[model samples]
Structure formats: C-alpha cells, structure tokens
Target: MAQAAREPDFRTRLQEWIPKLVLSPSVAAMVVFVYGFIAFTVYLSFSDSRMLPSYDLVGFGNYAKLWGLSAWWTAIVNLGIFASLYIVTCTAIGLVLAIFLDQKIRGEGMLRPIYLYPMALSFIVTGTAWKWIMDPGIGIENSMHLWGWTSFEFDWIKDRNMAIYTVVIAAVWQTSGFVMAMFLAGLRGIDNEILKAAQIDGASSWSLYRRIVIPLLRPAFLSAFVILAHLAVKSYDLIVALTGGGPGRATELPATFMYSYTFTRNSMGIGAASAVIMLMTIAAIMTPYLYAELKEKT
Candidate 1:
C-alpha cells in the first residue's frame, strides 16, 4: 500500500524524464551539427579570419568594410531585381499554363512531359542549353539571320543592362513547370460539380473561372508564392552557370556575393555577416505569407 502511494511520484518523474531521453539523440546531433557549427561560424564572423581561419578579434570591423563595399551594394540591389522578376514571371506564367492545361484538352499527357522535362534536368543543363541557344556565335540569333532576317539580335546574355533577365528566363523555364504541376493537382482536387452548377446558371466561362476557380485556388497560389519566394532569394546555381555574376558584376546576386566573400576572398567574417543578413532578409520577406500559411494550417 505504501509502495502504491509512492508510485504516483515515481510515475511523474518518469514521465518528465522520458521526453529528454527520447529527444537525446536528435538534440545531440542538432547541437553538434546545426547549432554548434552556426555558433562557430558566427564567432568566425566577428574575428579577422583569413585563408586559414584567423581568430584575432576584430569586432564588427569586417561588417563596417562590408557595408561600404560597392560590390556588396551592387549585389544587394541586383539581387532584388533578380528575385522580383523571377517570382513575378514564374507565378504569372505558371498560373496561366496551369489554367490552360486544366481544360482537359487532348494531348495533355504528351505536352505535360515536354513542358515538365526541363525540370528533371539540372540547372547546369538548363543553363548550358540556354546559353548555347542564345550564344552570339552560333545560336538562334545567327539561325534567325540564316533564315533571311538580316537584323535579329537576341543577345541579352552579353548586354550589361539586360543580363539578369536572361538568368530569369532560365529560372522560369525550370521552375514554372513545377508550379504548373502544383496548380494542376490543386485543380484536379477541386469539384467539377461546382463548375457545372455555375454553367447551369448561365455564367460565362470567364466569370465562372475568374469568380470561382481562381478564388478556390488561393491555397495553391499561396503555397506557390511561398516556394517561389524561397527559391528566388537563394537562387545561385543557375546564375553561376548562366552568367557567373558576369559582364562586370551586373548579374551579381546575394548568393554569389556570399560565396565570393567566403571562399574567393577568404573573408570569413564578412561572409558570415552576409549570410546572416541573407537569412534576415529571407525571413522578413517570407514572414507574412508564412504566418498566414501557419494560421491556416492550425
């Protein structure tokens, strides 16, 4: 009887301890891999690090230098342009494609693969193919001239003013198809009966789709927007393959800037500062949509 009275206290202790025991491995791994490494990076960011990771305390001296750097400033401004164009173009084109394909048209099976196959390939392939096709030496530009159009100059890749748009073209090619797939799945899940009822009420196709279909796909649009935002903010590979921040750094983006600072320049402190700044920027940009998404989820 006395042991039974003591059981309650033991059980309470056991319940409290079980969670720690259960979480021990994951916690350990996160500390070692995530938090530990992040802390080390942050520490390095404060010191005057170099080729071999110097540890002399320099306070925020590197950040002061970073803030004044023209390249960094250019990269920040250019990144904003890249991301805005990417998000807007991808979302608009993807939505249009998705709505068109939702008509249940014939040949969709074959066309779908052709449209989406670009996504299966790496950005390396996308960049290379696009670069070649737009190559000034022997691409569509020359091909167009070959076809008797004497003055067809499609060479934005080399233009300082318009190079970033070329990168966005490649990005949209890869990402828009994926967005279309997302919206198509959302469309399929929607009720056809609602459309039929709308039709019975003498609703025009434009009004029915606009007033009904678009509103219902809010979840899909919101989801796509969040994803596109994330991708745009951190986009690196395609830009590297396409331009390498080229034509006198006209296409320099935040990701490429971070890499150049960290690896090429051996400025670890500055690099970390850039990375943390990028994190803050991404969080700021995506927080509103993310909050709405979470509210919906809960």
Candidate 2:
C-alpha cells in the first residue's frame, strides 16, 4: 500500500512540473534575446561605438549630442503631431462606431466585419495602398481628371507641408477599427439594468451617456489611450511604407531617426541613445498602467 501511494505521488509531481519544463526553453530564450539584447543596447548608448558596437564607455555624451541634433528635434516634433492626431481621431471614430453598433442595428455581424477588415491587413499593405491612392499621377487625382473633374486636386501626399497629415490619415484608418472593437466589447459588458434605470429617471440619451455610460467606460478609455500611445511612440513600418520619411524630414519620426543615425550614418552611439529614449518613453507610458493593474488585482 505504501508503494502504491508513493507511485501516485510521484506521478502527480511529474505532472505538475511538465508544463514548467515545456515552458523553460521559451522563457530562457526571451531572457537572452529580449532582455539581454535590451541591456546590451543600453550599454551601447553610453559607449563610443560608431559603425559597430564598441565597449569604450563615454557616459552621457552621446545623449547630449543626440539632443543637440536638429534632425532629432524634427523627429520629436513630428511624433508629437502624429501621436496626438492619431490618438484623438482613432478614439473619437472608435467611440462613435461603438455607440452606433450598440443600438442592435440590422445586419450587425456583416457591418462589424466590414468596419474591421482594414485592421486585418498589414500596415505595409495599408500604407502602400494609400500611397497609390494619394499619388497625383495615377491615383485619385488622375481618376478625377479622367472623369472630367479637372478641378479635383488631392495631391497632399507630395506636398511637404501636408505630408505628415497623410501619415496620420493612414495610421488612423488601420487602427480605428481595433479601437472600435475594444470599445464595443466594453459597451456590451455594461449592465442593461443600469441603462434602463437611467432611462426611467427621465434621462435623455445624450445625458445618459454623458453622465453614466461614458464614465463607466473609463477602463476602456484608459486601455485605449495606453495602447494607442504605445503604438504611436513605436510607429515605424507604417511611416516607412507610407512616406519613407517624406519629401524631406517632414514625417521623420524618432524610430526612423534612430535607424538612420545608427545604421546608415554610422552614428551607432547616437542611434543607441535614441533607441534608449524610445524605450524609456514606452516604459513611462506602460509603468503606470501596470502598477494600477497589479494594485487592483492585489
């Protein structure tokens, strides 16, 4: 009997450890590739490396020079515009779509997919498609002219002063559907009793949303902001695909700036510094949300 009990105990212990053993390799890889590389990049930011990695430490000098560069400042300002407009437009459009869909409208399933289809495509595809559509020679402008609307001019993609807004437009189109889904889920989760209670209290539709429903959706709002802000900061591929940092430095964001300096310009130290700044920016946005989530769980 003692032998039988020992056999079952051993089996149970083995079962408990099997999942951990399976996961150990992935965890180790993440530590080495993700976190290990991050540490190395941070170290490089402080070194005198150029064109390649060097171990000679130079303190914060790289950071100082990085800030002094006009290109870096241009990227920062462009990011400000792009991030602000991208976040606001996506949120607004998403909220409106969510509210519209929550009314139990006909063909709901069909409409939801139609709205979300853009998100299914890769950013590269969206950017390339929009680029063709916005190009004056063979895109909308040409099509309009062919249709005899000679006065129809929509060549903003080639205009330096208006180029950054084109990036905003493409980014918003790709992301708004995702934000809408988040909000729709939030809306669906709201208690119908609460909405009915407000309705019975003589509250108008606008008043109900303004005073109660919107406030209750605070979690969704916070989540949307965090996700959008993170995306805005790290946005790279879309800009590269759409504008290629533009007719000039008009749409050059920090990510592009970092790549240009680090790899192309042989200013690896500056690039590393810029990369660290980007990492810090993401951390700053993420840290608060994480703390709040952990605190709430506890």
Candidate 3:
C-alpha cells in the first residue's frame, strides 16, 4: 500500500510539471528574443548609435532631433489622421454589422464568412490589390473611361491631399470585419433575459439599443478602440505595399519613418527613439484596458 501511494504521488507530480516543461522553451525564447531586443533597442535609443549600434551615450539628443525633423512631424500628423479615421470608421462599421447579424437574419452563416473573408488575406495582399484598383491608368478611372464615362475621375492615390484617406479606406476594408467579430461575440455573451425585460417594458428597438444594449457593450467598444489604435500606430506593411509613404510623404506613418530613418538614412539612434515612442503609445492604450480586466477578475 505504501509503495502504491508513493507511485501515484510521483505520477501526479509528473502530470503537474508536464505542461510547464512543455511551455518553458517558448517562455525562454520570448524572454531572449522579444524582451531582450526591446531592452537593447531602448538602450540604443539613448546611445549615439547610427548605421550600427554604438555604445556612446547621447541621452535625449536623438529624441530632440527627432522632434525637430519636418519628416517626423509629417509622419505624426498623418498617423493622427489615419488612426482617428481608421478607428472611428472601423468601429462604426463593425458595430453596425454585428448588430445586423445579431438579429439572426437569413443566410447568417453565409454572410459572416463573406464579411470576414477580407481579414483572412494578409495586409500586404490587401494593399497590393487596392493599389491596382486605385491606379488611375489601369484602375477605376481607366475602366470608366473605356466604358465611355470619359469625365470619370478617381485619382486619390496619386493626389497628395487625398492619399492618406485612401489608406484609411483600405484599412477599414480589411479590419472592420474583425471588429465586427469582437462586437458579435460581446453581443452573444449578453444575457437574453435583460433584452427581453427591456422589450416588455415598452422599449422601442432604437431606445433599447441606445440605453441598454450599447451600454452593455462598453467592454467590446473599449477592446475595439485599443486594438484599432495599436494597429494604426504600428501600421507599416499596408502603407508600404499601398502608397510607399509617397505623394511626397503624405502617408508617412511612424513605422515607415522609423524604418526609413534607421536603415536607409543611417540614423539608428533617432529610429530607435521613434520606435520607443511608438511602443509607449501602444503601452498607454493597452495598460488601462489590462488593468481594468485584471481588476474585474479580482
């Protein structure tokens, strides 16, 4: 009996450790690759590194110079416009789609996948496709002209004044569906009893949503905002494949600026500084949501 009890205890301990042992390698890689690089980048931001890593400390010199640059300012302004429109448009479209789907309309199963199909494609692919569709000579304008609509004009992609909005349109096309999924999940999780009670209390559909349904979806709203804001701040590939930060830097977001400065311009220190600022922006958006989530759990 003593031997059997000892055997079972050993087996139980082995079971408990198996998962941890399996996860250790991933945790170790994350520590070394993810966090280690982050720390190194932060250090480089403070140093006089340019073209390559340098150990000479320059303090906030890189940051000061970065703030003074006209290109950096242009990137900042473009990001503000892109992020604002991206977030608002995505949220509005996603919320509306979610609400529509929640009503259990016919072909619900078919429609959900159709709505989400764009998101399955990588941003690079989406950007490239949109680039073709928006090109003046071969895209919408050309096609319209060939069809005898000679006066048709849709050349926003080449226009400096309207290029950033084109980015917004592409981004919204790709991400709004994902936001829809988030809101849909939130809607599904809501208790049906509450909705029923509101209906019995003589609440109209609009009033019901405005007062109760929308209020309860606060968590979804916050989540969508945080996600969209983070994406907007770090957007690179989509802009690269679509606009290449062109029309004379009309869509030069911080990500593109960081890459161009660090690698091409040989200003690693300033690039690192910009990267740190971007990281901080993401952290600022994430920290509050994480705290609220943890607080609710506790």
Q: How do all models score by TM-score?
A: 0.86, 0.93, 0.91
- Clashing pairs counted in every model: 0, 0, 0
TM-score of 2: 0.93
Ranking by lDDT: 3, 2, 1
- Put down candidate 3 lDDT per residue, 22-47, tens digits, no spaces: 99999999999989999999999999
10 residues in a row with least lDDT, candidate 3: 114-123
lDDT of 1 by residue, 126-156 (tens): 8888888877779889999999997989988
Q: What is the lDDT of residue 102 in candidate 1?
A: 83
Task: Extract clashing residue pairs from model 3.
Answer: none
Q: Write the per-residue lDDT of candidate 2 for residues 131-227, one digit (tens) a residue.
A: 9999999999999999999999898889988899999999999999999999999999999999999899999999999999899999999999999
User: Which parts of model 3 are misplaced by more than 4 Å?
Assistant: 1-22
Task: List residue ranges in candidate 2 displaced over 4 A.
Answer: 1-19
> In terms of lDDT, which candidate is strongest?
3
Please list all clashing residue pairs in model 2, or write none if there are none: none
